[model samples]
Target: MSESAPTRPLLNLDALFDNPVFAGGFGLASLGAVLAFARRGAISTVGLIRRRMLVNVEISRQDPSYPWILAWLSQPREQTSFLARRLTRINKLSVTTTTSVTANGPTRASFFLQPGYGRHVIKYKHAYIVVSREKQATAKTNTGEPHETVELTTLYAHRHIFEDVFTEARALALQAHEGKTVVYSVRNFDWVPLGEPRRKRPLGSVILDEGVKERIVDDAKDFLARRQWYVDRGIPYRRGYLLYGPPGSGKSSFIQALAGELDFSVAMVNLSEIGVTDDKLAFLLTKLPERTILLLEDADSAFINRRKREADGYSGGTVTFSGLLNALDGLSAGEERIAFLTTNHIELLDPALIRPGRVDLMVHIGGATRYQAAQMWDRFYGDVDVDGAYRERFLKRLDELELFGEAKEGQPVTRTSTAAIQGLFLFNKNDMDGAISMAEGLIPPKLEAEQ
Candidate 1:
């Protein structure tokens, strides 16, 4: 009797949505509750499956493995791959920066393709694998480039799949760079690859004065081999070579060959580059890539206006001289490094910059010598001057015209560069006589005037 009295206003469908026990807008409370429960159950079931039956991995753009994976996937159809060909179809594709010299002429730079930024699938060894690539701007590179992450998922039993995939990818990447030199340059405080790997320049190709190449190579090898010695002595494991002379004297070439000989990469840093400051320089020096030789080209010219830039209030991040010095030898100086500085005007460089700890070895990569000319001739003709006959005749004519530097008892000779000599040889590659006839161009202006 009491319950019947309380139900005087009978509940209807409209009453159900008036902020009832489970309030819902528009839809009735019962329908909304049912939908919510189903949605939650679906989410829970999916999560449980992911946790119990699936395995996953995440690779950030910062990781070296990231490129390995991308490179593996982006390989063209003509190339051989372990899993790339197994992918039956990938509708979503992205164009990448990598390129190849295809027979196609002057087309757009869409030579390379990879799975675009979305969900992708691959069939590897008869197992299904899912790839999800996502980009977020919450993090940025030095140049404000978008940061990305790739997530890979597969069955729980396929955990070893990642190791195998990455292993093969890394090997492929290394094989591409094998027997080639990787040149790096700084961009926005980070070292980036400068260009396609250069065909390795053989050490024998760079013909220096006798004992010069050997001495430099031996020192670098010895220094690299004696890491424990430097550590024990509490000395920073750093070595610097200052190669100073006129332009085209093989200063840069020798460094490249040296790097190739030592199986090392080269990082070229222009200290006076815009936006390069004391802090940035220090940061770059500290974070140099491993097994890389730091090459500071035109060191003298780069810093000549360091003070002038500051005084003029040039807002660009110009490097300070003090910053350069500190980066070379201060607390921020990197260990296990080989530094090469090439300058056409060594005399203009500050003495402080070439001090003991900073510039350990000062080598003059001067003009081509009689020894160099002869060796280069033999090499250019693809023959050995075993009898010294070709060298004698070639050098004899060079002396007659003062093409090679004049030999005097006490006077310093102004000689031509190996590059210049090689250029002349190439101009008359078929005719040694033609090369000799063109030898007058090789004479230094001072020698010509004095004669």
Candidate 2:
């Protein structure tokens, strides 16, 4: 035998190309493209830095515009986007009519769009939709209390895209309330936004001492206009006031009026209310919008004497003294905003709550001054100007009643509270003489009741 031909080991040619068919049909270039696409898909699904963010209705109330955003996003559209993709959740065996109220409008029967998934294109990128639902007992139903499940979604996207969408959504929300004022309060441990009152009292309507009014207005103007100044000085752009005085002294009224004048919103935080814990307070305060007036009514009673309150059968809630102080000095404590703590007993307040950095001004809205009484008269009587004789007569009546007697030269007049005078006017109904006669009975007792 010819020197036995050395048998060459059988070569496995398929090993050269991991996927022989792909290489054969598409060639190396096309195969490379296919592999690249698969790699990208895998990265996007697991390795790529796509991010997810949650905006829970319960928690996001901290951001005032969150509700508006949800409304905007859920608004029903008459027509779908040309580039949109629709998803059908389930096909019903028989078509049934239904009516549902949506932000855009009401939908009846066939007019309703099927619940489905959709995408919205924003400036930066596309936002995908994924909804979650949980059965919850809701008080906001017309039917005999029913257990219903509502759908809420947490948006997912690249970080930049989410930021861009949020920024735009917030801008739109602010614009919606541009020339209007909103009242915000903490409800169920969340900030609830309420529209401006049907009848708003103008800032000019508040009959404050002339000097006090001027100072407040000037300070507000300076604070709101000094964003750059605060930034330059490394100062937290915030201001606080302690509106301490007797009840019905116009503390609350002044705040409401100030909101109107400044075109700002009012956020009322009542610490004595149920569920007002330290965390909730901090969240509410930190999330306040720019140029808002945060009113903490009855600040003195807000924290002190909590155990005594519990013992007295008051079951609302109690905030620890340290917690209140921490919240005031917390993350959201300092911003480009103004806060007012209205109290009947400033003496009961802790020193920390009224420390220098926390309270910038202390305004004592005492009983109606002679001038203030006159202004109240002009307002109720619809006068464009003060009547010297009417004012003098009113002042005389006040003196006879032992209300704040006429002021000494260059001194502020002391008198019964504005509320007392207001009650007299309200009871008499535009009868100046009648109100003057009833004013004495309306004088609050020398020792006023606790708020």
Candidate 3:
């Protein structure tokens, strides 16, 4: 049997007014007229009110005195009953509209209001947001007319997505002005792309075997904690990490993993490809976007054997040791900047660059541990559980071979030789499954493996 569809409810205007309570209420006839107008136009009461408000505002703008007369004529009883409240709301709305129009003139004025402080106007154009100090001055026009002019001096241009970072920086600047905090200004740095040959593989792609993943996570957590602590203390929250290890020890992979985990964009700067002098380098650093991870890969190669005072013909002129130092920790040092320097040889780096005040953390990634090797075996073989006896024998063999060290307590571990471990795992490709099972037994469980 077919069921009948339900009927929708309809508004009964007559019945609504027939009720003595509603009829006796104030402005009942006016309210009825409003409803009737809405029904005739197939519009809602909200739409009608909005249209009336806009019409009134337009009329008031054309004839500034018309609003008072219109209010008196349209709702004399309301004005008499709630004159103060109505006028207060109307005045606030008018002022708000006027301020909005003034602020959003020919050029948009970006302004934000802080609870305790006043409004701050942000000037944004192109890809930069200009932050400046606004000052009022009097100027004479060509016609000999005097007028007040607001002059703005550019303080900085922060890139997009770094707005929060800049906001914090601005707060820090304010505190510095009040002698409550130290202010560091970051130097401006430009990102110049190299016209080098493109590789067939995708840029910034890192592959991790199971064993190395765990270690990366642990180290990343530590890094994030340190960053948070700086933010909480309102300190210059910049971090400088040094990633050094063998060529194929997954140094780059670890970097990519960290960037991915932190959800920060990686801005890789190949120093060898940079043709800028010390002055330009300092500028680029100041202008780098906040909350960004700047990667200086192969830093050792860029400065290797180069004298600090040498005058190399570059785009920004001669670079000096003093200039380099100023560029790194100049007035424009921003708190949210994160810089990573990776090198194959740690010994090749200048002592100034690796100093405690320069790079905050120095992480040395060495060869893979035995735990890492076994984890890699399990990943490649897709077998978590292997024969216990065979695994023990294999582990003994690994210990005798000294393939990976035993996991120690209260000490930082290294998992460098990942490539070598991977190669070893694939050596017995014929019986890969059996080989993995045997290898797992030999690896110690105390050493944590990355996934």
**Most TM-score-accurate candidate:** 1
Off by over 4 Å in 2: 1-66, 69-179, 194-200, 302-317, 382-388, 406-415, 445-451
> Candidate 1, overall lDDT?
0.80
Candidate lDDT scores, in order, read 0.80, 0.64, 0.49
Error of 3 at 46 (Å): 33
User: Comparing 2 and 3 by TM-score, which wins?
Assistant: 2
Residue pairs with clashing backbones, model 2:
237-335, 404-414, 404-415
> Lowest-scoring 10 consecutive residues by lDDT in candidate 1?
403-412
TM-score of each model, paired residue for residue: 0.81, 0.62, 0.43
lDDT (10s digit) by residue, model 1, range 128-172? 779899998676656788889999888998888888889889899
lDDT of 2 by residue, 223-329 (tens): 88888998999888778888887777788888887887888879887766656765567766766756678887767765563453346545346555655666565
Global fold similarity of model 3 (TM-score): 0.43
Per lDDT, the best of the predicted structures is: 1
Please state every model's RMSD to the true fold in angstroms: 5.6, 10.7, 26.9
